[model samples]
Structure formats: C-alpha cells, structure tokens
Target chain A: TQLLEQSPQFLSIQEGENLTVYCNSSSVFSSLQWYRQEPGEGPVLLVTVVTGGEVKKLKRLTFQFGDARKDSSLHITAAQTGDTGLYLCAGALLENAGNMLTFGGGTRLMVKP
Target chain B: DVKVTQSSRYLVKRTGEKVFLECVQDMDHENMFWYRQDPGLGLRLIYFSYDVKMKEKGDIPEGYSVSREKKERFSLILESASTNQTSMYLCASSFGGLHSPLHFGNGTRLTVT
Candidate 1:
C-alpha cells in the first residue's frame, strides 16, 4: 500500500515564527498536493506540485516536491495566526492507478498571536 | 468557484441503524469522492465515483457503501452504524483528469451512540 508519513504531528508557534513540515514515502508518486483544513470544515487544496523538484509559492507558504517524487515539504515564512490549521499532504499515483491519492497523517499547526 | 455541498453538518444515530449521507457538487464535475477524517488519521478514502452509476472501493471501504445515480450527486451509506464508524465525513469533487484539484464540502460530523 502507498503511504505518506508526515512529521511533527502537532506544532504551536508564536506569530511571525517559521515552520516546516515534511511528507515522505518509499513509493514514488506522479504528483503531490497540499491541503489545509480548519475546524469543522473539510480540507481545501492549497497547492499541487506535479513536476519533480518543483516549488510553488502561495503568499507566505512554500511547497516543494522532492526530486524522486517520493517526498514533499511545506514551509511557512513568518506565520500568522490566520495560517493555523491542519496541513495535509497527499500523493497521487500514476494514471493506471486511476490517479488515486494516498494522504498522510496531518500536521496540526497553531499560530498564537 | 466550485461548491461541494453536504446535506448534513452534524448527525447523531444509534448503533445498528442505517445511515445515509448525501453530497452534491455544483461544478458538474465528473469525479466525486467520500472520505472519513479522525483525530490522528488525516483522511481515508471510503469510495469514489468517476461517472454516474459507477463506484470504486477506496482504501477503507469495509464499513461503508456508496451510490452515484446522478452526475452531480454522491451518497454514502452505512448499513449498520457502529461506534467505530463515528467520524467526520467529507465529500469532494473534481474534474476527471490527472492534475485537477479537488473541491471539498464542509464535512458532516457523525456520532454513533
């Protein structure tokens, strides 16, 4: 089975602090996606990285897909309280697998003002 | 903007009861998915449909079944509700392809007593 393992299951930091969360797996994927979920809501897609070694930025958030397509990372620069949420990484398998996704255990981030 | 709407925000049911959770998407996407979220496990896919009347088992489909009789609607069914099945159920939709991002609904929190 394809599995994505996320690090630092919980994080609490003051506003303006920086943090990085990682998603790793032994199996290679065709693409990687990051999502953020708030309390009482389903996850919303934040970014998707399709090419190996690709990096995508959305305001203060930076997402990176590893060269081998087996890992990914999300980094926040100067995190604000608004950035607090559960961050999830999902790996999408090849087309033959119907492009199905395998999600990692989430990283819950709390940014205090 | 894509909107995925779930029928219920919260539900309470007794053990051994049959339950149905409904979801609809306004984007007319060709793919829909059902997932369950727990405290530690981020999100586990239960079922998915790529077309009307077509269903596929996902990673954790043991306690659940799904129906997709219409293009814009997907339903998740619990034949026999159990305490272990209590979770936050999420509904998502996406255009059929390799790189499409999923649009999600506000989840339904189901409690089995």
Candidate 2:
C-alpha cells in the first residue's frame, strides 16, 4: 500500500514564528492535498497540488509539491494562534479509483501566543 | 457553500452495543467516505462509496460496515461495538473526479467502554 509519512508528529511555536511540515512517500501520486483540522472539528482542505513542482499560496500558507510527485511540503509564515491545529497530507494514487486517498500520519501544531 | 453534516458530535456506548454514525452532504457529491482518526494514525479510510448502493473497502474495514442507500446519505455501522473501535469518526464528501477536494463534517467522537 502507498503510504504518506509526515515528519515531526508535533510542533509548538510562538505566534509570528514560521514552521514547515513535510510529507514524503515512496510511491508517486497523481495529486496531493493538504488539510488543516481544528480541535473538535473535521479537517478542512487548505490546498491541492496536482502537478509536479506546483506551488499554491493561501495568504500566509504556502504549499509545494515535489517535482517527482512523491513528496509535498506546507510552510506557514507569521503564524497566529488561530493556526494551532492538525495538518494532514493526502495523496491520490495513480492506480486507484478517483475517490481513494491515502493519508499521512499528521503533524499537530500549537501556535502559542 | 458545501456542508457535510454528521449526526452526532460525541457518543459513549458500552461494549457489544450497536452503533450507527450518520452523514449527509448537501452538495450532492457523488463520493462519500468514512474515516477514523487516532493519535498516531491520522486518518484511516474505512469505506467509501462513489454512488448510491456502491461501496468499496478501504485500508481498515475489519470492524466497520457502510451503507449508502441514498445519494446524499452514508451510514457507518458497528454491529457490535468494541473498545478497540473507539476513535474519532470523520465523514467526508467530494465531487467525483480524480483531483476533487474533500468537504468534511465536524467529526463524531465515540468512546466505547
């Protein structure tokens, strides 16, 4: 099975600090997505990168997909207290049906004020 | 606005009790998924349906079963709840496409004793 592994299972940083999380996989994927989940809520999609070397920006958050489609990264700049949550990366396998996604272990971040 | 609604936010049930987790999507999405989130295991897909009456098993479907009698509603059933089944259950829906982003509902936290 294709697995996505996320590094630094936990992170705590002061507000306004910058942080980056990594998601790596040995298998190449057709698409990759990043999600942020708040406490007591389900994860919400932050960005989706479909092409290799693709980069998308959402305000202070930046996401990049590896050129080989085997990895991705999420970087947050000037983090705020509201950014405390769990970050997850998911990949859509090239051989699977359109609806299946394999998710990473996740990175829990705490942005302290 | 896309909304995915989970029937309950929290639940506690004794062992051997039957449990049902309900999910509904108003966006008329063709893909519905059930996942369980644990501390070290971010999101493990239990089951997914691409259409009404169509179901597919995910990575961890041993103790779970799903039903999708209607297009917008999906149900996860635990025939006999066990302590090992305790986890945060999440429901997500997305349009039927290769790179469609998922829309999630506030998860249901279930505790089995």
Please write out the lDDT profile of model 1 over residues B48-84, one tens digit for every residue: 9999999999889998999999999999999999999
A12-101 per-residue lDDT for model 2 (tens digits) = 999999999999999999999999999988899999999999999999999999999999999999999999999999999978767688
Question: Model 1: which docking level applies?
Answer: high
Q: Model 2 residue B53 lDDT?
A: 100
Best by lDDT: 2
Using all chains and alpha carbons, the TM-scores for the candidates as numbered come to 0.97, 0.97
Instruction: Give me the runs in candidate 1 sitting further than 4 Å from their true place.
Output: none
Off by over 4 Å in 2: none
Model 2, residue A30: distance off in Å is 0.5
Clashes of each: 0, 0
- Model 1 clashes, total count: 0
DockQ of 2: 0.88
lDDT of model 2, residue B65: 94
